[model samples]
Target: METRHLTYPDTPDAYPSVMVLGFFDGVHKGHQAVISHAKRVAAEHNLPVTVVTFDPHPKQVLSNKPDAVRYITPLSRKLKRIEALGVERCLVLTFTKELAGLSPQQFVDDYLIGAGAVHVTAGFDYSYGKFGEGTMETLPYHARDQFTTSIVTEQTRRGEKVSSTRIRKLLAEGQVDEAHELLGAPYVICGEVIHGDARGRTIGFPTANVLMDASYVMPRLGVYATRVKLQDGRTFYAMTNVGRRPTFYETGAVSVESHLFDFSEDLYGQVIEIEWIQFIRNERAFDGLDALVAQLKQDEVSARSILS
Candidate 1:
């Protein structure tokens, strides 16, 4: 898939295109429905499929206070997942103060028009430009003479709306299985394996320490059954922890560490992707190293049983 950093001045090449527009935080089932519709439209019209999304989510820029929720996916991961949907091109618009100041009409004229898109597909609740001045209700009329528009309806699973926000809420509440069902896949965090204190090595279970991308929503602190994917794309059953090293009296930043079951290798500096499958237990401050190690053994047993 081709990716572009779209700006006001840059226009798409001259071609009939169908575009999918939204923040697409988790690319959950709802977002997928929008993309799926866009793809079908593109196929019927014989136009290239393009996906347009903004960076730093509009919420981040529009927040008056500092406590707005963090993002669920970084631009890289967002684009990767969207591309996996078989879109031909992904245009990542860098949202800035200047860009946000444009009126809804100005935004459509500048970005959507610039993309040469004749058909645009988005969710029913999608809004854009200058304090959300443009909503789905207002967009089709604004584009009446310009292009075709389709507002995809909400997608629901188990009677609940499938959405990035809903998935994040589930993850934060430690309902990973429910989140996965909404996401249509397991929740995975990809990051580089950084060096830690090497304490796991001393305990005979050397682990790879992963520093996760801040943009990705982390699940509730706990030990989880996970599938670890290496840079080479090999996957393995694993047990992962998300917490401070309480047994060693360490108290600062929470870390994610994974012990790949029955695997031994030097993984320093490697990028590892962890697919969280199931939650095991909440993080706790164990009494000593032996206690922690003993609990980890139990965790591995539970993880293996669950995964197998």
Candidate 2:
């Protein structure tokens, strides 16, 4: 798939194609449904599929406070997911205040018609232009006969809408299994292995300290059943701890460390991706090394069973 990154005033070459639009954080099940429908539309119309997404997040530029806005799937990961969906081209527009100031007609004329959008697909709630006054409902009127529009209705899970916000809530609550169901896949985060206090090794459950990227939304502090993939592509079932290790230190940043079952090797400096499978238990302070070790043994058994 071809991915083009553009700023305001820079546009991709026009071609007859179907364009699907969204911020597409996580590209969860709901976003997938819209993309799936776009694929079908493209197939029927004999046109290539183009996915248009934004970067740096609109809220980051628009909101006065500009919250950190951690992403469920950052730009690199989001592009990978879009490519896997069999899209022909991707346009990642850099969201800026200048771009946000465009009027509804200006946005459609420049982004949609200019990008060769023969047809456009977006979720029903999707909005664009200054103040987000333009919505899917207003999309057709703004089409200007240059393109067509389709709106994918809200996708629901167990009667609740499947959304990036909902998925974030699930992760924050240590409900990874439910988040997985909503995402249509496992929740993944990547990190580089780093040296730690090496306390786990002395206790018999050696772990690789992982320094995760801050941009990835962190799961709630807890233990989880996870699958780890090393840089060499070796995979293993693991018990991952996301906590501050209160027993060892009363104050420190939260850390991610995983004890890989049936595997042991020098992992420092190597990178790994952790795929969260299920929430195992909450992280807590142990009385001492003995207590922590005993609990780790139980965690390993539970992780092995769940992973199996």
Candidate 3:
């Protein structure tokens, strides 16, 4: 899919497009339904399916506590998911204070109309423009008959709405398996393996320390069953820990460390992806290195049983 980064008064070459609009942090199931609706409309109108997403998340720009904002799938991963959904193009608007000041009519004219969007689709609750004054109910009033609009109703699973917020909550609670069901895939973290203190090796469980994007939401601090994929496409069943080293240090920075089963290779500086499968146990301080090793052995057995 083609990607275009735009700011106000800058638009891509005009082409007939059926656009799906959302922040789409995780591109979770509800967001997928909106995109799917756009695709259907695009097919009917013989236009390309396009997605309109914002970067730096609007909240990061508008919130009083911007640093508190986290993402389920940061821009890079979100775009990948959009492309995998058969979107032909993705137009990412860089959120700024200036753009945030656009009036409802101005946003409709610049982003939807100016971009040649013949039809637009979004979730029922999606809002736009200064102070979020534009709603799906108000979109047509802003469109002025220039384009069509579709508002996908809230998608539900197990009698609850499927949403990015819900998925993030699940991740924060270490409910990865449930999050996966809502996401239509396992929750994944992409990062590069970095050098650590080499403590895992001394404990008989050599680990690849991962430095993940801080913008992405982290699962609850725990040991988890995971699948690790290397840059070269090799995948391995693994056990992963997301926590500070309480056993070795009284206070330390949180880390993501994965011990791949039957794997022995130098992964320093290598990019890798980890898929969270299940929460094995909460992170805790062990009595000593031997106790840590014994617990890790139990974790490996549990992970293997679950993966099997």
Candidate 4:
């Protein structure tokens, strides 16, 4: 899929297109429904499917606590998911203060009409323009007959709405398995293995310290069963810990360290991906190395059982 990044007043190529609009942080099931609807519409109209998404998240620009923003999928991963959904092109609009201030009519004209969108698809609650005054009901009025619109109704699972917010909540609570069900895939973290204090090796469980993307949402601090994939295309069952080393240091920044079972390699500076499987135990300070080692042994047993 082709990617186009644009700022306000900059128009996309004037190709006849069917666009699906959303922030699509996780590209969760509800988002998939909207994109699927747009794909079907594009097929019927003989137009390419275009996915319209924003960067830096509108919340970061609009909310007072911009630094508090975290995402289920960063832009790079989100775009991959959209492309996997068969989208032909992706337009990443830079969300800025000025763009957020546009009126409903201006947004419709600048984005839809100006970009030559012949049809648009979005969730029912989707809104545009300043203060989100443009509802699905108000979209056509803003379109001025330039394009048709389709509103995908609420997508539900287990009697609740499937949403990014819900998935984030689940992840925050260390409910990775539940979040995976909603995401249609396991929650994953992509990072580079960096040098640590080499404490895991001393304890007989060598670990790869991962420096993850700060934009991604961090799961709750705990030891988890995980599947680690190396840049060299090797996969291993692993036990991952996400926490500060309270056992050694009183306080420090949180770290992600994974111990791949029955594996030995020098992984410094290697890029790797970890798929979270299940939370095993909360992070805690043990009395000494012996206690920590014992606990880790138990964790390995549990992880191996689950992975098996």
| Per-residue lDDT of model 1, residues 1-308, tens digit only | 99988665555564569988898988888988999999899999888888888887766766785345566667887788898999998888877777889889888887887668798889999988888889988888767567889899878887888888788899998788888888889988888999999999898778899998776788998889999999888899998888887777667788999999989888889998999899999988888788888988899899999999
- How displaced is residue 232 in candidate 1, in Å? 1.3
Off by over 4 Å in 3: none
**Every model's Cα RMSD, please?**
1.7, 1.0, 0.9, 1.1
User: Which regions of candidate 2 fall more than 4 Å away from where they truly are?
Assistant: none
Task: Look at candidate 4 and tell me the lDDT of residue 122.
Answer: 93
lDDT of 4: 0.92
lDDT of 2: 0.92
lDDT measured at residue 281 in model 1 versus the true structure, 0 to 100: 97
Question: How many backbone collisions does model 2 have?
Answer: 0
Alpha carbon lDDT at 26, candidate 4:
88
* Poorest 10 consecutive residues by lDDT, candidate 2: 59-68
lDDT of 3 by residue, 112-183 (tens): 898898998899999999999999999999989989898999899999999988999999999999999999
For model 1, name the residue pairs that clash.
none
TM-score of each: 0.94, 0.98, 0.98, 0.97
Go through the candidates in order and give the clash count of each. 0, 0, 0, 0
**lDDT, residue 140, candidate 3:** 90
- Local error of candidate 3 at residue 258 (angstroms): 0.3
Q: What local lDDT does model 3 show for residue 81?
A: 93
Off by over 4 Å in 4: none
